[model samples]
Target: MFEGLKVVVGLISFILVYRTVTGNCNKYLAFAICAIWLRFFLAAFHTITYPPLIVGFSINALGSISVACLGLLVIPTPVFTLKKFFPFFLFFVCIAISGFVNMKIPGTINVLVKWCYFLVLASALILSVRVQGQNATFKKLLVAFTMPVALQILSVVLGQAKATEADGSASYIGGYNHEAAFSMIIVSFIFVVGLIERGTLSFRTSLFTLSVFLLVLVNYRTSILTILPIAAVFYFTLAEQRLKPSQKAPVMMIVAMVLLSSFLALSFTMKERFADIGLLLSNLDLMLKAPIYFSDAERDIMSARVYIWSQYIDAFRNADLLNQLLGFGPDSWKGRFNLYAHNTFVSYIYEYGVLGVGSFVFVCISVLLNALTLKDRKLSKILALSFVGFLAMNMATMPLWNIEGLIFFAILNAVLIGHKKSSKSRQVSTDNRELLNAN
Candidate 1:
């Protein structure tokens, strides 16, 4: 509820400022900053709480309200097709069906509600992207979205100084657990938004730089260790191949240094024991077998998940031909097994069976291809990095299953899928028009 309050206030503040700016757009951006700041704080603070609730509706409310705002903004002016948003609507329908079919579990209804919240967030973000113009509104949206990174930085600081030294602390930060997954997902969102906004305004670029610094402090070792190096290599190689010779050297140098510095800083902080890899690995090997690391009690909980997954697999495999095609129903899984799949892919398979999985895979591939089609060399590189980094982060932890992570991924996919080929085209058109008039 505390978190819910923050979100509600943030949205009201943003709406008030949006009204006050009188079309300035920049003031509206300040409102976005406040909203995002509140969101990040709530998400970071609540990561440890089970069945995370909307304590302060502020974090949850803004996205839904913002979607409505986008709808209103675009209804008066025609920037993008409202129909382009239909696929997203279809995607949510699938999620709803999945939830209802699996409703037998203890908290299945709550999960569905959370799913609805995430869908609203995804819609809001996608709508915001669609409504973007040369106007300042889109920039403000990105600025507001970046606010979460600030909260992550604070969490990382606290997490670093006093990480939990026990196993149930799976949700604690900088502890090589799931919290790191959430942190990395939020950082990836910030990183991509920064890249997109780099040329928008000097102030925005400065904010981008600040975001990078804070991201370093947020220190999710797995993502930092992988994304930094991969992004650097991708940036330089892609830039060298794509940009003009004159434009290559400067960008490469700047990107390289930022990635390197961030990588080193994060690595040093979270992985002090990794300072001695051989010893750390040997100790980790023993730790895995120790009572504290894999206690009987903890093992039992994990084993229960295994049991649930097994039941899901058996149910599907043994289903008759028709049931296999249509699926068991959304709430069916919860009723049948008393558990939600902790694994996202498993969850999808349980709900939709093969056909649903196929459709999901199709959407994913479309997003990937769309990202590849991005013409802006910089935006292209950023999306590529995010896709790879995000996928890797999700392997060990359930980013897709986490509400915050779901919003982050869905928004990111929308950005990648809906991002228009502009900036360069607009610049060239402006230059050509000026030349013709001069002649």
Candidate 2:
């Protein structure tokens, strides 16, 4: 009976995906995003300590390989759409180059596969929006996104979280393996959800926003930097909609007060995080430059991020000119230190070197600029703000390094690409109209 039920559910899901993509877009990109919820669901089993279970590893790589193979199927890539993100393409090229130079084929292929995943996923989503229409596409996205997040929250609140901090504190990551990635996803969720449902702060919206603040209060304090500005934008926009021009200042004050109050109310619980601010400020210079080595005493500070980042920085400083410009290679830090760089920028500079990090920064700048010029001004403003938050995140953690961060981006960017071209979707046969030309 259980096996039959599994097959029935699989069939239903397959049918739903088929209808959603209109038989043109392949299923894996959507399946991968859908699988993210599954990853978190599997985390529940990991949370079990009674007998111990080893669930499947993340499917992000599998998803990437699957969609990337679409290129092998002769579907032309959306080269036109991808041109807008050419800098990112350069970043990928740099990674592959660094890998070949360093002779790390597995590491090189891994990053390349993820890039291909993003490429094909973006193409598929853009086609879905064009074929399924904005409301339906976003509705499907909302449901897909909402479940994992809600389940994650429930897991944390119930104390089933398997994630912990370097200092052995509860991170409240719930189903996520890391707190920073979860926090980044929260930021993305706010932006994407708001994009789908825009209006004054309904009771539900206000409550959801408050819940996010509370959740962050208990874990990943740095995320607060990104959340504050983005949340303020959304909340203040409500003030604009309802208040008179003369009342704008007071409404802004109120928004600030609301955010402040949320922080203050939870201050007692996050005393350690607040202290980290002082720790970082006091050691600002050392944080940037130090010897490639630290004693055990120094390694315990700032959750060892200070020591961890310094090793990466000092190595980059001492690297040969060629490696300095091109980077040592993908995941090179792991071989030396047996650890990932806690800071994304620091990691990129050491691993991919100047060319890789520069291309990444350029991509961020170009995307932000183009976001403003988008015909859909509302989406432009929200997404640009969200991207800022995402950047703030990258300063401390590698949001783009994880699958959750990529999922929301693929959705929002797909909307940005297809919303305007929606008219052209009607030009071809229903079957071929929204087809992915995945180059």
Candidate 3:
């Protein structure tokens, strides 16, 4: 069953990349879709199935770098739009400098390459919208996400769910190496379908989100923190505004069905997971109510995320002025403490410095502002609200450290900013024509 599922992902990737290289499909769409599979599914699957190393590097590194190169080749010319893209450019510049100054040469180079890959990915998404228009591009994204959804369902059906080391817990990994990674993928899919294609409620999207939420419950519990508030905003959108009264009823019914079904499925399908679920509830108390300090108990909270964060902060606080400004270096945490800080701000602040973390936050703020300004109100609100969940994720886990997480917000921000830019261009053109007629 595992081999069969791997075959499915392989075939899907081959078909998409072939269509793209052959000019049978949009290069941006095909490449973006295939990159997700390559980055999220294939690399890990390839490793365990065979010798993952060529020379010294793992297949994961090789495959991701190869895909990054392809993205650069297929991407449009880089856009330096201040709010849309420049913040990322500025942010990566900080990363590069910190990497160089701190002498983390090899790791910094690898990190910068990934940063470049992400920039290319964002550019490709924006170009797709500008050329193909929003509706066409978003429809493809909606279709693209179904592969993950299918894999999730199949994992459950075939009983191929992987177990995490903690308490030998069964994680609904859905063909990915880690359930956390799978949860991140589902979060991206939610933004793709639920927020990106707002107001265009369809059977495909409704069913997709239902499975997505259900699978999320059975996977990494951190995503439950991310998805719940977004789900609330989603429900409110369905009921309070966006759709007309006539259109609201069925969507509301769908929302109710989705939530109820997801919980019921969780209860029946994952009885053993209840212990983990109980931990999730308990952790929520630590996460929300417990104040993070230098205490040992606080350090132990949320899988010791707070502890690591406090340590990272303490280290950063004690560092010299140069190190404080620039950071000890990219990925320096592993060298300094033998573990990742596990929180985005904590990790980046220590490794990339205050300046680096500031730019990173700027990129996020830019996404929120861009999403808020989008022409689609439902898309705007849901996406903006989803940012709360995103920020929450960053506080507890290092979601930004992964390609899927970066690409998720990248695609979203691209769509938001690109659509706005395209609309503005058209309006300006129309205005010019009207002026000429008046003259």
Judged by lDDT against the true structure, how good is candidate 3? 0.67
For candidate 1, what is the TM-score?
A: 0.59
Query: Model 1 residue 163 lDDT?
Result: 40
lDDT assessment of candidate 1: 0.49
lDDT-best of 1 and 3: 3
Question: Cα lDDT of model 2 overall?
Answer: 0.63
lDDT, model 2, position 112: 74
Ranking under TM-score, best-scoring first?
A: 3, 2, 1
Model 1 backbone overlap count: 29
Query: What is the Cα-based lDDT of residue 165 in candidate 3?
Result: 47
Residue pairs whose backbone atoms clash in candidate 3: none
Q: Tell me the TM-score of each prediction against the true structure.
A: 0.59, 0.78, 0.80
| Tens-digit lDDT string for candidate 1 (1-439) | 4345335544654464455344544322333334344444445434443342465444344443453354344322221223434454455555556545644333444445555544444444443443444224345455444334433444455554334323322232322234444565446455544444434655644554565555444444444443553346444654566568797779778867876786676566545523433343344343224233443443443323333444566677677875576466555565566656545555666676666666666666665666778887666666666666766555334566555565566556656644555754544333223322322
**Every candidate's CA RMSD:** 8.7, 5.7, 5.8
Instruction: Identify the candidate with maximal TM-score.
Output: 3
C-alpha lDDT of all candidate models, in order: 0.49, 0.63, 0.67
Ranking by lDDT: 3, 2, 1
